[model samples]
Every structure is written in structure tokens, then in C-alpha cells.
Target: MDKKNIKKVVLAYSGGLDTSIIIPWLKENYNNCEVIAVAADVGQGSGELEGLEEKAKKTGASKLYIADLKKQFVEDYIWETLKADAVYENKYLLGTSFARPLIAKRLVEIAQAEGADAICHGCTGKGNDQVRFELSIKAFAPNMPIIAPWREWNIQSRDEEIDYAEAHNIPLKITRETNYSKDKNLWHLSHEGLDLEDPANEPQYNKPGFLELGVSPEQAPDKPTYVTIHFEKGVPVSLDGQKLCAVDLLSQLNKLGGENGVGLADIVENRLVGMKSRGVYETPGGTILYHAHNKLEEICLDKDTYHYKQGIGEKFAELVYDGKWFTPLREALSAFVDSTQGTVTGDVKLKLYKGNIIDAGVTSPYSLYDEEIATFSADDVYDQSDADGFINLFGLPLKVQALKKLKLGK
Candidate 1:
């Protein structure tokens, strides 16, 4: 907490009220040190980035760094999650959860370049993001000092933050009544706060400023929509025969899937810090990708490998959710995922309608589903008489237990 020796501090600035206030607060409290702001553009869009440099300057930052991380965000972080088939608690796509590490990494880079004595963030102490940011910083740059203003400052509530912004002449994106905590990027949009904190309360999508991305299922189109997703080596390559880039492919899929009301999940998941919080997320493209990828895995992977890979998927989700992104276990699990996906090249057709994903078709060159061997009809692919010995050996435990009971009774 010593600010006397600090000549400069680099802040992970979002241009939000909290981060806007931190720039001035650091200067005032940290012996008038220079504050450099870093706004990471991880596909939250150019709109949020617009006027960000000017805003940071106006808010007393000596310099501002706006790093465009959209393409890298999707290809490296989001697609990796897709490849692993990692879903937190069978629902969450880890949208905001995965974004923090990339942002923090850039924060450290800027901090080192700026020669700042410490790095700062606007995340509050209560939320999961604080953990995600700090843990990532520790993993990447262990010796760097992290200054969390919310954990240290006197501002205790969002109302106090707004008041501080007003007193300090800071421009903000939300007011007290209109604010709903939202995290947005190319992959998904997450809505929290307002009525969502209460588990008994149903969502009020009809209210203005309550929803994002697109319409809800009750407001979706009546007709069903079908699309084919082609994958090579576990990465989605095309949509409906059109070969698109990763970002464009996901964008097109989101538009189509959103129209059909493909994805909307409401869950109160357990956080790593021993608390359950409710969040409403809309991940249109991710839902579709998960289905197609899982379907390909079914036909491509063998019995034991497929079942065991399922366990690895769960562990991967946990590690990612817990912010253990730099660990060896995640890398080892990714290796297993990569090996299982060697034969996962195929296309899966899915029908989306009214918040449901239906499997329409699936085909793969390495599919183990031979109709001749699996059919019950008369065929020369296998002799039916050969099953007697196979069944006896397969059920040997049952046969031995039954014979033991018979001998005891006699």
C-alpha cells in the first residue's frame, strides 16, 4: 500500500465509472504519480473504444494504450474452449471468465513498457473477475505489484462510485436506474444485476434496457432453420458450404442461430470463492458449435477414449473457470483433447428452433459406424453364432455369482 516510492502506475482501464475514477484517485493518493491507462479491445467493439484515448487523457492519465485483441481473442481463447468442448456447469461458455487473462496479460506488457512500479484494475473485491485478473498476473508476471482500488479505496457501493464520478467530472456509460452489469464480446453477451441477483425472480426481458444480443425465445421466428457446420481437426471451418474466416463464421452463425432462438441460459453457478451468483448469458454461435463438435466426437472417437475424454472436458472447464489458465494440467488435458480430435473431421447439420438444438445429420470419413456390422438383418459381415462365446465371457461375473448361489442352496 506504499505509494511514496511509486513513480508511475499502469491501470487496466475500461473507461467505465470505476476505472475513470481510479486514474485521478491514483494521482491524488499515490504521491502524484503518472497514471497510464490501457484499454484492451477484445471485440467489445470500436464503439466502446471510441473516444477512449481522449477520455483517459481527460481523466488525468498521462498516456493511453488501446490494444486491439479481437481476432486473437476469438482464435486463440474462444476457439480453444470450443475445441476442448469446455462448458462450465454444463451451461456457461466462460465468456467473461476467459477474457480476463488476455486483458491482464496486456496490462502487464504495458506496465513493463511504461516502467510503472505497479499495475491497477477497477474490479471489485467481491466478483470473480478480481481473482481472474490477479491470478493471471501472478502466473505471467509474479513479481509485479497489483493495485486494486476497490479493495483499498473508500468507495463501497456502485452509488458511491457514481457520486465519485460526478464529483470528479467523469463521463459514464450508465446511471443508477439504467445500469445493468453487462460483459460483451464477439462470443457472447452476459447480463447481470437488476432483478437477476434474486433466484426467485424471473427475468424481465420485456423491460427496456433489460436484454441484449437479440430477441428471446418467446419472440423468435416460428419456422425452423437448418445449417451445416464443417470441421477439420476439431475447428469449425465453414457454414452451409461457405468457407469463412473464424470471426466471420462465428458472426454468421450468431445471426442465424439468434433468429431461431438457439441459446439463452439462466443459471446460478458456484464461483471458485464459495458463492453462487446468477447470470443470464446469450451464446448463439457457441451452442451450435458445441453440438456439432460433440456429434463429430461421437462417431470419431472410440469407446474408452471418448468416455475418458468426457472426464477431461469437465476438468478443463473447472481449470479454466478457476482461472488456472497457466497450469500444466490444462496443457496436458489439451493434449488429450487434441489426440481425440485427430479423426474429428466431419460436417454436422443442425436444426435450430425455439431454444432447441436438433441433430439433423452427421458424416465423417473416419466414422466407426459400419451399418453391416451393427444391423440386425441377415448379412455376411458377421456370424450370429459367434456371439455365444462373446456373451459368456462378457458376462462371466454374473454367471459365476449365479452358480455360487446355486451351489450354496444345494
Candidate 2:
């Protein structure tokens, strides 16, 4: 927390409102420390990254480093989350959750390389990103000092942040009326704050610019769109029939899923800081991928493994959401998840209609579904008489307990 010790600092900058102001704030408060801005290109699109270097320099940063993390983001973080089926609170897809650790790790690397005395982030004190960034930084550089401007600054609100930016002549792209906080990546786009803060307020999806990645279901086409996804050991390898790299595959799916209004979720989720927050997420490609992967698992994984994996998925979601990505438990859980995905290779066709994803077909080479055993009609593979014994043995404990209760009655 000592300002004198920080002669140089590496900042996780996005060229956003918070980070734009932090450049000058760091210089001012840290005795004119040099701020090296670091931006992670995790598929947030060119619009957010374009002209970022110029902006950072104009705002007082000595230099800007934009790391192209799209391939790693999709292949390493996004794919791993998909394989684990880890959805936070049965709603959130953990798009922003996992990206934080990756960005923070890069920040640590940049700090070490630059021989900086400290790491800085724009994440606010009340949100989850602070914990996520700090935890990942601590894991990589335990002794590195972290300066969170939001936690130390006098700015109380977004309005005040804008005032400070204007006072300092820092240009911003947002106005008071359009200042809804947002996070975007290849996996999803989340909209929060402003009108979304109230749980009762329905998302203004119909409003212009409210939904960036897609449209409202009401605005979707009447005709349904069918798409086929191919997976190899639980990783999506191709869309329809053409094989693609991880980034390209997900990009194509995002276009298809967004056009059909495939992934739109409005959720009130519990934050790691112990507060409920509402957010509307657009995860078009990710939603389709999850649906297809789960369908493939239905035929591939056994009942015991599939059911048990559901629990593991929930816990995994919690760990990812809580910023424990570098912890031993999360690594162990991911190992277990990987073991379950050995046979999760297949193709799943889905029909997307007005925000609903309907199953068209599913096929897997390692499918455990045996038609003869499952058939209700006459089947030699599974004898009907076997059910009589199974029922008797399965109900033995219940039957004995009932009999004992009957004997004790009067």
C-alpha cells in the first residue's frame, strides 16, 4: 500500500471508463509512477481494442501491450469450462469469471518482465473481479504489491468517474444515460448496472443497443435454423461438416446462434462478495456448444458417471466463479472432468427457434445406448422377468422397514 515503493506498475487496462481514469490516477498518487498498460485480446472484438494504444498513451500510460489471447482463451479456458459443463448457478456460463484469471496471469507476467514494483487493476471494490484478479496475481507473484484504484480512490459512483475523466480531459465513449457496465469475450457478453440493477426491471432487450451480440426472441425469424456440431473427446472440432480451429469454430457458431437468438439469459446471481446482482448475458455460441456437448454426453456417458458429473459441474462452476482457478481442488476437479470426457466424441444436430434449442439428432461412436435393451416392445437383450427380481431386491430395505412399523403399531 506504500506509494513510495511503486516506481513502476503494470495495469490491467481495457481502455474503458474505469481504466482510462486509472492511468492518470496512478501517476498522480504513486509519485509519478510509470504505468504500463496491458490489454488482453480475449475475443472481445476489434471495436474494444481498436485505437487502444493511442488512448492509453494519451491518458498518461508510458506504453500499451495488447496480448492476443484469443486462441488460448477459447482453447484453454473456454474449452475446459465447456468440458466440465460448469455453468454458474444453472444460468451464468462463467464467461467473465474464467477470463479474469487468464488476464491477471498475463498481468503478473508483464509485471515480472517489466521489473515493475506493483500490479494495478480497474476492478471495483464491490465486484467479483477484484478477488479474481488478486487471487490469480497472488498465485503467480505472491509478494507483488497490488494497487486497486477503486478501493483506494475517492470516486463514489460512475457519475463521479465521468466527472473525473472530464476534468482530466480523458475522452470516453459513454454518457450518463448509456453507462451500463458490460464485459465481453468470445464466450459471452454481460450487461449490468444502470437499469439492470433492479431485479424487477426486465432487460430492455427490445431497446436499441441494449443487446449487442444478438436480438430478442420476438425479433427472431419465424423459420428455424438447424446446425450440426462435431466433437472430438468433448472439444468442438467442427460446425456442420467443416473442421475449424478453436477460434474460427466458435466465431462461426456465434454468428449462427446470434442470428437465431439462441443464447440469452437474465439472471440474479449471488456474487462472491455476498451480494445478489442481476445481469443479462448473451452467450450465443457457448449456449449451442453446451447444448450439443450435453446431448453427446447423454449417449456417451454412463448413468452413474453422468449423474455424478452433474454435481462436479456445479462445484466446478462455484470454484471458477469464486476465482479459485489456480487452487488444488479446481485442478483435481478438472482432472476428474477430463477422465469423464474420454468417450464424449460425437455429432449433435440442433434446431434453433426463437431462443429455444431443440434436439434434432445425436450420435456418438462410444454411445452406451442399446436399443434392444431399452425397447419397450419384446426384447431378448433384457428379459422382462429380470425386473421382478430387481424390484424385490431394490425395495427390500423399504419393505422391511414398513413391516417393522406395522408390527409396532398397536
Candidate 3:
């Protein structure tokens, strides 16, 4: 916790507004200690990654550790969250929320590996990421110090940060003209700030600082686009019947979903920090995957399990939003999710048309939906007499209450 005694620091750097100047700030405040920046390559795209190594060093980092974690990210964090059907506030795919834990985990690992005294992150005091990063680091290295510049520094606003960067000659990838704070990854792209700060203002997606990954619904194709997604054990395995890796599969879906103007969400959500923030999110591939996966679960999962898992999904979303992914309860919940996903193997055909995903068909070998038993036409599998006893047993308490009311002669 003592800055003077700190000899080295590891920072979660994304070359964004908060982090671009953190390397220099850490070096200056922490007794001119060596600052090592670790950037997670959670598929934010090649442009963000291209010049990062040089950028970190130029900005005063002793070195930059670029952890190529796209596959591990999708396989580990994204898939598990998806399998649980976890979406924050019924809309947010939790793209940024889920990625924070993974990044923080890597930061701790690198900090310990480098024998650093403290781990640092660039999350603002107003944001949830401060809790997400700090909690994750504490979970692993309880005693290691955490340096949060946004909470401690004199540089308060974005303008102040820009002034600091310019004074220090930090080559920022962004400019003051670029007002919106953006977070992009393989899963989704999120836009905050700009005119979006006003909840009443309709988000102009075609405008700068809004649209990034996909086109607006109005700009999407006139005709419908069909996508056939294949899943094995609840995870998507292929697109249009061709087997692709997790990253590629999601990427492919992004293109398809984007072309159809799907996965654009404008939401004002409850922040883990207590304040509500409005954000526009582009989760193209993730939208298709969620819809397709839910369709698969409709047939694959039994009615009881299907309905019960919705509550679990809400809890899972809460846990993720609260940055409690490393907790025991999360692991146990994940185990429960895995148990319910055994029969969730299926192919879901979807029609993506103008921001709408219409179901085409769903098929699975493990489907619990028995067409013969469910059909309106009479089948030998069902007996009309069975419902008499079933309803009697089910309504016995209500019937008893009714008899008691009648006997009371009210």
C-alpha cells in the first residue's frame, strides 16, 4: 500500500483514455518504479493490438505484455456465461463485465510473475471495473497492493487526463475530438458518452461514436438471411453446418447478425457502483448465439429444468455483474449449469431480418419435446382420463379451501 516502497507495478492497459497515461502516472507517483503494462488480447480486433507494444514502451512502461487470450476467453468466460443464459437486465450480453475478470486474472498472474509490489488498473471511480479488477486481484493475491489512479490522482476529468498525456508526450491513439468511450472485443462493441449521455436522445447509430461493429437496423439488408447454428453440449460448434472454432464461429455470426441489423441494444442499466448509465451495445454474434441457444434449450431441456434455469440465469447474471466470477458460489452455479446443458445439443435455424431473429426450425437427438404426445390430434401415448386424477391431486389444497369456505356459510 506504500507507494514509496513500491519497486514495480503491473497495470491493466488497453491503450484507452484511462490506461494510455497510467504507465507514466504509475512511474511518477510510485517512486519512479518500473511500470509493466499487460494488455489482454480478448479479440478487440487487430487495429487496437497492432502498435500497442511500442505504444506502451513509448509511454514509459518497462515492457508490454500482450496476452493473446482470445480462444481462452471465448472458451472459458464467454461460453460458460452463455451456457448459463446470463444477460444483465434482460439485454446486456455482459461483454465488458465478463472480460474484466479474465483481464484482471492475467494482470495478477503477470504481477506475481514479475515480482511486482502492486497491481494497477485504469478503471474510473464511477465505473464497475474498479471493483471487478480489484476484487479479482485480491482473490488471487490478497496482500498485494492495488494502485487505482482514477481514485487517487489529481487528474479528474477526461480533459485533465488529456492535458497530462500531452504534457508527458504520451502518444494517445485517441483524440479529444473522439469523445465517446468505447470498449470493443470479439463478443461485442460498447459505446458510451457523446449524445448518449442524455437518455431522452435517440442514439444516432450512423453518427460518429455510436456505430462500430455493425450497421443500424435501417441500414441492414432488405431480404432475410438464414443462419443455421450447430451446438454440442450447449456450446455453438458451427455456422451454416460448417464447423468453426469458437472465435471464428462467433465472428461469422457477427457478420451475419450485423448484416441483418441484429444485436443493437440501447439500455440504461443499474451499475454495480449504484449509479445508472446509458449505453449502446453491438453484440451481433452473441445475439444470434443467445437466441439460437435458447431455441435449442426449448426442445432439448425438460420443462422443469428449462423453467428453473431462468432463475439460475438471473443469479448468474448478477454474479457476473457484481464481479463475483472467482467466488465459490459462481463455480457451484456453473457446475449446476453444466449439468443442465448435457442434453442441450441441437441445431437451430434462424431467420435474421431487420433486427429480428425469427425461428425457422430446431432439431436435436436429445430433444425432450415429443411431437406425438404434444400433438392436438389424438395419440395412444395420452389418455384423457389421466387429467381427472392429476387435476384433483394438483388442486386438492384449493378444493379443501373451497369446501371450508362453503361450510362457513359466508
Candidate 4:
């Protein structure tokens, strides 16, 4: 690829220190190609988007394209993940990992529509997002050249990035000593870097940069707070019965869950590149959504279907984490997820307090639970005599092993 042939480039810019500097660097290195900055508003906040166009222009980007993808992000990506009960390493809600593909998809769309010659991003070579972003680009537009400045440039660290931004007059709001590096959206908020880079040291919740969602659990209210989440076909449609859109529902849940100091996680997770990194996450809405959706599935799904789907859920999490969202395997896994979610229409009641999700009640038209059969003092719904044959068949292998052991001893 000739540097002179590249006329224009679209960058997945975030208006952060790294991306702000990237606009100028791309222009400098790519034969002064026109750099168009595209920032996806995946419900990070309007505060971050405020004056973004002006910021881009001030930082030397020819233009800035801000796409409001909050609703679509939640409905398409977040809810799709929620339906599968997808959680990476049994803990992480994958806030940052999931957003890359959608952002890259939009980047591809914008690039094709604008007739841009190349696409670029600020992700470093070591991180998972570099893989996620590039893989999505390959999946959608394989011919488009990807310009990863971090992997190519001399900027070695965030400190060097800060120095570059300062020298170039990029107007960065962050400092080098901040305790955490955060990524936020409607689904979740992630915190990495700083002391979190050291696995042995636990995160300090009291620091200014460390806390955002709410007060720490130690400072949370003592009593439990109850909330009801309504789901229609596995999509969260409302809170406590009031109909709301995807963004609105997530907003309300974040507020409620945050007030109670819920949705905080400290995890040492395996990165896609096979390294373990410690991160603290705040996933208020995603926490509520995953738990509630699972509660609804408990009522809606049968035994074999439920157990088998659980296995699929684990695999689904792996595929998403590994940036296989646009692949055939992901589509097949989603098909299985969708099939299981057909009857998963219902509501879940939950109690939130001090970072805990507690069960209140779950109700669904397709509920598998039968109180009559499960009751200790039961009637014709279930016969006690049936247990003898059932246990005999179910435990045949164990019984035969015990008999063989006894015979050997005699």
C-alpha cells in the first residue's frame, strides 16, 4: 500500500488523549491525508460528546462524525448477549470487548459511504481490542487497509501519548497519575490500568479516579431495595411495569443499582491474547439484565433444554470474547440462543443492595415449576412410590459399583 495513494482515512476516535493525538499523527504520517474522526455514542454519556466536533477541529481532524448508537447498541448487542447469559470467565460482563465490534462495524459503514481509502483506530498491539477491531474489519471489508498507529509509532506508553498530546496542543483532560483507566456505556463501565495492573494489590475504592458509578459498598445503604424488570421475548421493555426504550431502561437501572452500590466487580480475567489482567467493572444495567434474564429462563426453559443451553452460553461467551461475533459459529450459536429464548417472556423481581443481586420472585407463562408436585405434603400431582423406580434407574451405575465392592470384600 503506497502512502501517496491514501487520500483520506476514517478513525474510530474517542476524543480521548490517544485518539485526539491520532488525528494529527495520521495526517502527519499518511502524506497529510484528510482525517475524518468518527465517534460512536454507545451511551458512554452526552457529557463526553459535548463540544466533540469543536474538539476534533481544534485537534486538527478535518471533520467529526458522531453517531448516536445508544439504542441500537443496547437492543442489538447488549440484549443479544443478555439472551445468551454470556459472561466471560464466569464474571466479566465484557463491556469493553463487546463495544469494539459494533464500533468497527460502524467505522466500516462510514468508511465505505464516504469512500475513504483506509480506516484507523487507537488500540495498541498488545490489547484484545486490536484483535476485535481488526477482525471486525476483516469480517466486513477485508480489502480496506487498517492503520494501527500504536503498533507502528514510537509512542510507547500513555505518558508518551500525554506528552505528544501536550506538544501538539491536543487539550487532554486526563493526567498520568490517575488511578484507573475507564470505559463506560449503557451496558457497563470498566476500570483498568494503575494499581489494577498489579494482581497482588487490591483496587482502592476511595480514590477519586477509582470511583464513578456510586459510593463504595461499605458506604451503601444498609437495607435492601427491590426493583422489578419486565422482559418481552428476552428484551428488557420496562422497569417496575412502565414501558421504556432500551436506553431509558438501562439508564433507570444504572441509577437504581448505583444508588445501592451494586454492579461492582474485581476480576483477574484471561485476556484474548492469553495474558491475565486485573480489572474493576461497574455494570449496573448489565448486572440486572443478566440476572433477570437468567431468572426468566429458569421459569421458561425445560430441564434438558436449560442444561444444554447453559453449555452453549459458555461457548457463546468465548466466541464473543475472541472477536468471532461476525463468524458463522457465532451465528449458529445465536440461532440456538434465539430458539431457547422463544418462551423466555416474563418479569423478574430482584433486591439490590451493597453489590449483591438477590432473588425476589420470577414469573412466566411458560414456567416449569409446579408447586403441587414439589410440595412436601403432596397429592396426586406426584406419587411417592414413583421415586423408587426413578432412583433405581437414575442411580443404577452407582448401585452396581457398590454391590461389586461388597462382593469383593466378602
Candidate 1 ranges with C-alpha deviation above 4 Å: 405-410
Write the number of the candidate with greater TM-score, choosing between 2 and 4.
2
Models 1 onward score TM values of: 0.95, 0.99, 0.97, 0.96
Candidate 1 colliding pairs: none
- Most TM-score-accurate candidate: 2
Compose the digit string of candidate 4's lDDT tens values, residues 212-314: 7776777779998999998888888989889998889889998888878888899998888888888888887788888999899888889999899888988
Name the weakest run of 10 consecutive residues (lDDT summed) in model 4. Answer: 206-215
Candidate 3 regions off by >4 Å?
none
When sorted by lDDT, best at the front, the candidate numbers are 2, 3, 4, 1
lDDT of 1 by residue, 1-410 (tens): 57788889999988877788999999988988899999888777677889999999998999899888878888888888888989889898898888888888888887887788999998888788889899999987899888998888888888888898899889998999866778888888888777788989988755655656656777778888899999998999999899999888988888877777777889899988888889888888888899899999899889998888777888888888888777799888888788788899999999988778999999999998899989988889898899999998999999899999999995
Local accuracy by lDDT, each model:
0.86, 0.94, 0.90, 0.86
Task: Please name the candidate that would achieve the greatest lDDT relative to the true structure.
Answer: 2
lDDT of 2 by residue, 1-410 (tens): 77898999999999989999999999999999999999999999999999999999998999999999999989889999999999999999999999999999999999999999999999998999999999999999999999999989899999999999999999999999999899999889999999899989988888988888888899989999999999999999998899999999999999888888889999999999999999999999999999999999999999999999999999999999999999999999999999999999989999999999999999988999998888888877877788999999999999999999999992
The per-candidate count of clashes, in order, stands at: 0, 0, 0, 0
